[model samples]
Target: MSRDSLSPRSRLVHDALRDAGIPGEIVTLPDAAATAALAAAALGVEVGAIANSLVFWSDGGPLLVMTSGAHRVDTAALAERLGRTSIVRASAEQVREATGQVIGGVAPTGHPAPLPTVVDEALAEFAEIWAAGGTPHTVFPLTFDDLVRLTDGQVAAVD
Candidate 1:
């Protein structure tokens, strides 16, 4: 499948990538890529090459963690990194409300506001990475720099 032929969220992701001056084309897979392992297997890449857009609720507000698939975001460590007391996983509704996309399909971009974003340092190992394009079956290729610029994310230790 192609990125052009997809749902509204996927299309929006595609357009956003172009608007952000990033070279990304939508890739549709037969499998439901709801997890980093699944996406890595489907794309035939390292698990770290999958940029998992994770949503969390912090004392400050909604936080977006663009983490590498190979590692889990240590929330307590992340909270310390952000100088916060706590960080909790966002509810499904909170995730949708904050990112304007479903839980399994949230992209790094296309949120209503500029979410406080943290990008995993592990993702830098890949020249190109794939992130969900606002849908479970959809993804778009991106570079670490482009991902940072597009999401206005800060590079940090997520795990």
Candidate 2:
């Protein structure tokens, strides 16, 4: 799709990726990819290859976690590793306030600012991974290493 055809949020994500020198094409889907299953189906990829961007509340700030769709995030273990008392799921308001995007559509990059981000180490198993493009109906593909580099995310066992 042309750059002008993208939604504002998706455009931001596209621009951010370009500015970061990451090469990928942002694809617009005919349907919403609100869930990993949906996104996987739409992209004809395994669910495990989908990177689910999630926001959490930790140390009174927003934490972004890009986890594999195959497993749930182990918040307790992750929190302990981060030396935090706890990490709870952020609310819709908190997510928007932090990422400037709503749930089901948060991208690793293009947030209001650089958020403390953690990427599931399991995602490295996939040669190519798909992530939301700041919208439920848009997505982009990238290598696991590129994902880590673009987000400047810490590689951790989130699940």
Candidate 3:
């Protein structure tokens, strides 16, 4: 679909993408793909190619982890990697407050403000990566390099 027709939230994400010089555009799925497995299935790609946008409450504020679908973030390991005392999942309210979007549709960008983001090194294995587009049913595809450039993320082994 055209950028002009994107949902309001998605339009924000689209604008962010374009402003960042990313060429990929958002696409809406017929069904909601709230989970990485579901999104990978809908997009007919390996589950590992799905970049899950996970929000965490850590270091006294919000953290965004763009991790691979095939694994979970090891909080203990991540804490060590980030030099933080603890890392915990953010509440739905906190997620919305930090990202300006709900849990199921939190994109890596388009937040109310900038966030500390981590791009999984494992995601660099994929030729392309897919992430949510500000809503459950919308998504956009971009390369691993695009993701790093878009978020100014720290590349690390998050899982």
Clashing pairs in 1: none
Task: List the candidate 3 regions with Cα displacement exceeding 4 Å.
Answer: none
Better of 1 and 3 by TM-score: 3
Higher-TM-score candidate among 1 and 2? 2
Comparing 1 with 3 on lDDT, the higher-scoring candidate is 3
- lDDT at 43 for candidate 2? 93
Error of 2 at 123 (Å): 0.5
- My TM-score estimates for the predictions, one after another, are 0.94, 0.98, 0.98
Clashes of 1: 0
Predictions in order: lDDT:
0.89, 0.93, 0.94
- In the range 1-159, model 2's lDDT, one tens digit per residue, is 777999999999999999988888899999999999999999999999999999999988999999999979999999999898899999999999999998999999898899999999999999999999998899999988998998889999997
Off by over 4 Å in 2: none
Per-residue lDDT of model 1, residues 6-101, tens digit only: 887877777788789987888888888999999999999999899999999999589999999999999999999889889999999999999889
The per-candidate count of clashes, in order, stands at: 0, 0, 0
Off by over 4 Å in 1: 1-4
